[model samples]
Target: MKNITKLPPVVACCVVIATVLWLPESASLYAQQSTAAACLTTSRHQLSKSGKQIFDIAQKRLNAYLASTKTNRTNAPDEPVHTIPVVVHILEPEGRSLLTDFQVHEGIAELNKAFRNQLPESDGVDTGIQFQLAVRTPDCSATTGINRVYPNNPNYTLYGVTSAGGPGLPYDQVYPMSYWNNLEYYNIWVVNFMDQGAALAAYPTGAYSPFDGTMITASYFTTKILPHELGHALFLGHTFARAIGGGDLDLIECPQNSNCAEQGDYICDTEPVNQSSNYICFSNANPPNPCNNNAPYGTVLKNYMGYNTFGCQTQFTNDQRTRMRGALESLRTGLINSKGLDPVVTGQTIPQGISATLTATGCSGQIQWYDAPADGNHLGSGNSLTTPVLYESTTYYASCLRADCPSDARVAGLVTVGPGLPVHLVRFGAQVTEPNTVTLNWATSFETMHDYFDVESARDAKTFGKAGRVSAPFRVTSGISEYRFADTPEPPADIIYYRLKQVDTDGSYSYSKMVSVRMQEMQKITIGPNPAGNSISIAGVSRNWDIEVIDARGMIVQRLKNRFQIDSERLPAGLYVIRVNMENGHTVARKIIKSQ
Candidate 1:
């Protein structure tokens, strides 16, 4: 990542300070306490300037849409939900800094909970929007909706920086390496933000820029940060943006009773808030700081758009929801209705003994087959795939061999293994029962000529080696035979893929469908003040692991058994990796950006 040079001058406005966080800074910037107030001001201002024409048009369209829906009452409980396809690009240093699948799953889960109003509060409104992991890619292949890139080019991480060469670069120059079609999918880049910013986003303005997307740091990706950024992408603004500039603007009324829509965030339900101070918390134990001039409602501290603490962010107003929906229907219609490429594999559910021919298409290059959706062992490479007699329901996918198109976007074919298959390979699956331990189970009915079953494992689908084997029944019978095997994975192993090889008495054999399980992380540790100045704080675990601070060259500069701060005041600005070695032999490493 490039070091931040200097921030360009931004026009002074009530929201001017709100946009200041995105400015480039050196190490000295870390010493200053950060205020969460008015985080959205900068983007809002930028959009209003660069996209004024489109924004006005979108506002008019939103008014019309809402007016039409006023009498129709669109949000019926039985109405089918609207879904927006999303593609996540995780740019980490090599594979060492990779965010785990479980983490991304949890992040998306939280996003769903917030959007569906599933959170524990009546104020949360269902935004009438659903975010789905894009199943198909631009070349029309299957995908897990997540793309991980360990870029060879270092320039990929300089987000928000312009060509003048500051600590960050514009999204067009920095993010195009992994971005999908902005029209078809909502692109989100999870990287180590150069500015130590929680996140940043671009608002919808009818016209699509290649740089149009949201950028968030990995640590903040799991919080309300997702919805907050999505809100910007969907054309919503901060609830208190009006109070950003100094004073003497216009409409700076109290929250108790005022012209809500015209005064503050342009939403009637959201009370006006003064952005002069940050609200650290909204709980009874630590209430928000007093509102400016003692406004009756204090502030709209609990709204997602407010600069409230992460834990306090809860809901969006009905008007905000209406505005976002209107934007989706108008400016973002391409993303809302896009159906990328087509189905590469097509077939219906069938019994285990049956065979189905699957075809791949829309790829300029060859195609490879995988049993699992994202990263599993490669089954084969060809224009088509024919299945062998199998047990258990399986999802088969085709991958486009185009170098530019690595993630799958083609619709995967689901072959349902019904119970009627005679092989009765009945059940075969794998799971992580505990840290480092994976349990494999399988059952067979009427063993017949079956000799033994070798439980095989692979880090990827292509490499298969025996973990252990279970003996088959000595005699043929109609009763079901159950078998289980447990194995402990060693260091650096986070996920294990397993399959079963059923060998017959005469040495004939058939492999079962692949199943993959992600290992539980030994411990979770978090490092704060990430772009650290003099020291960094570590938490989550009880410091039960050995800590090592390593520089870019893979040399450990400091080691400790149990300690909090890794003092780096004497060190120069650069990228560093903190490796935590647990007594259980599990090793975890995270990338940290240090400022100069």
Candidate 2:
């Protein structure tokens, strides 16, 4: 039995986390029997409401969303592709705003790839939402979507910014300086520093006055962050921002008894998550947290909406894609209709260390040169321009003379940056070897000031313990260093997260990107095992099980899929998430247990 209705916000003071709710502005709305309205109205916090018609529409959406969870339905294939124009504003100081045009372009590419479901490991559907660098300014002027602005203060940083309206914030002073038509373009501000959060965005609801678009921290910029923030702009919420039941109480999302559409993040396809940040890396095992509490278990993840690791944040669900598409056609039609992806000048690509001359032939006024596509560094004003030395690939945008009035779409020039040596972790993965043993492996591109490697494992991603240490190789093997570790001494967790603590000879250290694997998580699935985490026999079916006995840490301790019974006697006691491939070409992850 699924429950509907949920709490308004964090009013109940009993919820754990992900308790975000959009409350009405009206005091009486809660005064009336609006689920847990007594908590909200009784306190000073009164939900606001501007109109009743809007409330009715929201209710209808909630109801339809609620019905979506129980049944499975495919979205219409004829959904039109949505294209949005984007502008990234980079603020002052070289130390803080550490983004390059090539990186910005890469970020955009990642966003598109995630939306289109191009990731190989992901099982999500494509949401036809696409984004392109805005070729034209608000008044139909030629410009790249990237903007580079230098404020009066050298160490200028943005403070007091929120996702919604901010009346007296410093952004009010900065908006007039760097703002374009918010209705026409999706603006993004890349500031040196912000006190609010890593990134914040505005939803499609038109209710938040004076504040629009997204603001992100330069340090936290990634393919994952931009896509997530934009999801909010296109009518999406955090995966954890749901209640267990629909508006019944102000509680965080839980695995059991959830009304997905209304109470949860307003979507059904994505399984309910507990602490979103805890379940970041679920797919490959080193999940930040294996959260979903009920039917769908393990690290039930793949969507960008979850507060998971960037590597684990892959795609959007079909339901999420539909929601975004609807928002484009209905709520954000103006931005949709804008000439964002219009034709620009034939872009030029030059090799690294070489400068190129970009020419805009048909401009009626003097050409304004920019480093990025829309809102980037302003080079100078000229028809034909010479560029600076390029170490990395860069896209330059050009506009017309007038700051106002309609001009043609911005022309673009691209300089291809040369590829540099790979200095980061190439692969950090783990796999189960023989029964009761797990092996961790890693490789690096090249090491300069290298010393030794420390393998770290964590039950949860936050608190990691050093597993073992290995010294650096005598020399680079095949232009890379490969290392392996077999865990004879392991923890008793359902999943294990692993990362490499790379220590240079100077004692300075940096950590590699985290990766995870399932261990003893199978506590209650298919295998007939001890309740404490030991498998004894197969309960139902005998042959064709193809079961790999997974322990509590998500590691496959034994393989007995075809036969049902394996060396389950050797498995350690705990939970497990094992892959159960079925004869119907379907697969399921069931909890298994081993008898003591």
Provide TM-scores for the models: 0.49, 0.45
List candidate 2 segments past 4 Å from native. 1-78, 94-97, 154-169, 206-209, 244-258, 283-293, 296-300, 343-596
lDDT per model, in order? 0.63, 0.56
**Error of model 2, residue 15, in angstroms:** 22
Candidate 2 lDDT for residue 434: 34
lDDT tens readout by residue for model 1, 188-230: 8887654435566766655556666777777667777688778
Best by TM-score: 1
Model 1 ranges with Cα > 4 A deviation: 1-48, 120-123, 154-163, 167-171, 244-259, 276-280, 285-299, 340-596
Q: Clash totals for all models, in order? A: 18, 78
